[model samples]
Target chain A: MSDLRLEEINSIHFDVLKEIANIGAGNATTALSKLLDAKVDMHVPNIEFMEFKDLAEAIGGAENVVVGILLTLDTGIDGMMMFILESDSAEKIVNSLMGRTCGSLDEFSEMDLSALQEIGNIIAGSYLSAISTFTNMTITSSVPYLSIDMAGAILSVPAIEFGKISDKALMIESEFGDKDTIINGYFILIPTLEAFELIFSSLGLM
Target chain B: MGTVIKVGMADLNVCKAPDALTTLGLGSCVGICLWDSVAKIAGMAHVMLPDSTQIRNNDNIAKFADTGIKETLDRVLKLGAQKSRLVAKIAGGAQMFAFGSNNDMLRVGDRNVAASKEMLKKLGIRLVAEDTGLNFGRTIVFYPENGNLVITAVGKPSKTI
Candidate 1:
């Protein structure tokens, strides 16, 4: 077996990712429109690719880190989009939406569990599908995993603690909806050097 | 007199006497607090999203909206709050995201608000007062004794809900 040559590998540019994001976002918008029976609006305020260290700084003060699944659906789109949110933010989002007094996670009951997972699955799944089409890549996603405080663990990695995957970070802040119901989705997309190359090459801009 | 309960996000703290129920940082999220002044019983929940189907759990409670509300209500009832006398006060659910962009995902916050309202309706609890929607975050405090609610918002004025 011959070793894969770096020369033969393809990589994606930041611009390519941005374009893909635009397309993926459009797909997500269309999906939302059909679901809510209302016009869906969205925004991608900032997008950039950086190292892992930079990604950590962006997370700033996240008490508990939630790393959702790295999932792939048969919906046809490729590429991967992972959903990571601070545990506090996740709880807050659920609590506020239900119109109940905000309490700790210990207060949640059986019904709440089903609701959160359903929403998480839909948003994360749809978002990734859009990214795949925009990038024109066939990337595989794993079943989304819920990593409780994984960020802390990741940061604690011996190499990361000293700084290893410092430059594999990408961040995007997206907002949607009207005056009555506004939602913001903050996404941090990080890719390894290998993955990065594959993405750019797949888009033919590498 | 009734007991008042106050709940915080990710944590639960309740009192069975005349007290206050409060929740903060509600954006597209809901603050549901039930109070029975005569019984001096109160229960509060600060939910950030609408449901919890996405969250897989092995018995850890207070993480989802539907279960969060039900649990809080049940706790209050256990504290001697009669369902008929329970009055609901709500605040939060501001549209934190702006419109007119290219990326369009489901607005989790909005769906949350709608879900909360439906749940309340199903519970047969009359919402005495509510402060929801718009594009901002809110901090709500409820005094069960007199049915007083003080809602303070960031970058906005504090008003009673």
Candidate 2:
């Protein structure tokens, strides 16, 4: 298999990435719906090769406060996956899970944080499992690390990882939310350059 | 009131008295602010990595702490800032997420902060103040007129150094 650069990624490659994102996010959305016991809607996944500076703009702005759950792909792929939600959305999810009306995100207790982390773990597991099954790759993820910070700060982890190799990063982003409360959560997947080549060759696209 | 000039990630810029330099959402990346109070000139660089020499694609000088600080200093000097009167204040370099594993990539924040201070010392610039190496991200604005570096973080009080 030939090495693939971010700049050299063509429409066909994007289509495959999108399909992977679709399968992964579709499973995640289903898992979310089951957990929440409510119908959830997911937007078509967007695969974009973005500069490090523009990564934060995907969720609104750099300084926008967000709750981020990050996990490293330990096997089969060398990269990371992130589940990001706006502060209010995270609060809403925690409230829904615990069946309590937690007025604000600022007042999240330790239990609330743990609940959020568990939600992240479940959703991320479902997403990865779907991708692993579809591509026949044994993908395993590290324990989720949770953080509440600015979108820019949270995204910097993956951006720095990508920056080591290139100025731009290729991300597969999917947005899923509840219909009533409109709790929008973003799922971002960033595979390393070598992982991209492996994925393409696994599917005989290279 | 000065206009806020935004410095993007892995980027640098210089401005005068009435214009301030700002960079948003610095996580594991350091924002270096260099000022010549007498000249009322300021420069800011948002560096992503610790060293440029260690990487093969080192063309983007503004992407590393060592090179980024030097380039920012050069730009400010060209804008009439005196090198002898230059002082530096830095913010950002946060470990946004904590993990048990001892991966070097996760320690980029500390490395960036250390590299930045080393570069400032090598350039003969006095390191006056800093807010770094915490588990939170920071957004910083640098004003040359007063040499104040204002740092703001989520769920934390904003401070000026």
Candidate 3:
């Protein structure tokens, strides 16, 4: 990982990042499953080098209105962490939390929205804790902010925040959910170039 | 047989009248659509940052407000857009979330909008319409023939400016 640019990373480096994501997102799903009392399953994670434009299409498309929970990282690794879900999945998770049927995706009341944020907080908390414990780094996440909008818009914050140092983003995408397969959501982890260097070096993978 | 030209992130493109230009999922980024009514020329740029001067090795002209708008203007001008007749309609510079930590990086959306406006003013192009600054994302489809920009969002009605 020494002298490795995030934009043009090699296969081995991607594997290292992928492994970190596996453990981190793996814990995320466990936390989420416990909260919903649903047996959550996680799909294999993907690490890709993408431009800002392709990021929106990765989840669905730019026009696909989805729910996202974002947490800004600052303790050690600087970047953004996001949890995204389709409208239906978001409604399902919120409904389960409220102990009632959330009629439809578009019918979220203020209480439902807040519950979604709490869901985001819990899942992201576990994800960050896993990364910190594994790497022995002081990584911290900010309060969760929820947004339900175009995927492109939700991803823009990270693109600009890390744009000056890297043109393309090194992102890890992981999908997780329950047996009904109704809770399909993406746990997107975007770390800065410096953060990647630190992670790789700290883990002796570099 | 009309074309809907797609403009990628940190990229810009120009099209003639009866053709439209579009960019998707603009969170903290700005999508500047410039129209030359008489020539029926339209150009759109998806800029990711405010100023290129802050960083060295600023190779991509379409990634910053200052350089992106300049390059977009140049392309439209070459495509028969008269400098004096060009007017701008902008969209997509919304703060997607609020952060208690006022890190300058988190506030890039507000700065991006300000930079776009400054560049528009500097280029002496009139900003006829704008849809910007909210906690939401927008996808902009710009029609050159009528200078109408269609702004779309999730869970919200589409609007034409």
Candidate 4:
């Protein structure tokens, strides 16, 4: 695996991974739309192999303050899934759900925080569930931990784990909700090296 | 303008005074900076894990607090910084995520901070100041010119130590 270059990944393998992500995110969109009673749509997921050093760039910026929901994979694949949302977008979500328009989250109540967590849980749960069904494998996920901080900081959890060996990590990026201005965010999935191989072999792409 | 050196995650670097070094967005990972006021030399390390011994095949010395801090001190000494005059100012090692359980992973920030302090003690280094163990992230810039470490975070006022 050390000799494997991301640039040389088979196009067919990339396509399979993208399709799986799309299907999973598609289910998440439906789940979110139902929860909010608002129309939710997703753009085509852009999947690529990214270097650990560039992880912050992949999100927005190193110092960019954002809301993140990270879930650790427990079974089938040892990996991580993160939901990244801009501050205003997250505030927009909280307001829309609570039926109150908020200009800021500095005074956000406990319920407000939990609402965001629940939203993260629902979306990630549905996405992982879809992937599990498609692959016919068990993919257990830990509780979603929500945080609001610099994009680099939020992403460091996985970056640290992968940086020890591989310089690159496979990144799947998808956007959901408003495409114009507010109410937009990204969903990212990173599988461990062994799991990466497992995914390819499971899909017969290897 | 001083040459600003950027230290990537789980990495380490050294620089002389009149120059600067930085590490961005530390969360559950500590950015350890050692500086010699007289020599005007500084070394910065972005450490991810507390100990390298727990993990097999640990090839990156800069990823662990024990080795990273030790190596940074050694490198700084080689660059004309006297060990006796060295002092430490650290930042980061934030919990980042708030969870209700006592799970060890969630307490990584606390553990990292403790490990860093322990390593500093073993190396006979004095920790003059620190900004750590919160539910927020930090970006730190170290200036060896005056042994000042500037810490910046979103929606928070920047501070210098």
Where model 3 places Cα greater than 4 Å from the true spot, the runs are A1-4
Which of 1 and 4 is the better model by TM-score? 4
Would you estimate the TM-scores of all the predictions?
A: 0.45, 0.95, 0.93, 0.87
- The candidate 1 chain A region of ten consecutive residues with least summed lDDT is A155-164
Per-residue CA lDDT of model 1 for A116-205, tens digit only, reads 555555666565666566556555554443323333222222111112123134556566566655655545454444455555656665
Model 3 per-residue lDDT tens digits across residues A1-206: 33656656677777766777778778878888888888888887777777766777887887788888888897889878888888888888888878886367678888889989998888777778877876889898888898888778887887787677777765667677756655676776777667878877787777
Off by over 4 Å in 4: A1-12, A100-102, A178-183, A204-206, B100-102
Candidate 3 docking class: medium
Report the C-alpha lDDT of model 2 over A86-199, residue by residue, as the tens digit: 888888888888888755777888888988998899888877887787679999999889999899999888878778778877666666775667666777777777888888
1 or 3: which has the higher lDDT? Answer: 3
lDDT of 2 at B37: 88
DockQ of each: 0.01, 0.83, 0.76, 0.54
Error of 3 at A139 (Å): 1.4
Which is the leading candidate under DockQ? 2
Best by lDDT: 2
Stretches off by above 4 angstroms in model 2 are none
Q: iRMS for model 4?
A: 2.0
| lDDT of each candidate versus the true structure | 0.54, 0.86, 0.83, 0.82
Model 3: residue B101 alpha-carbon error in angstroms: 6.1
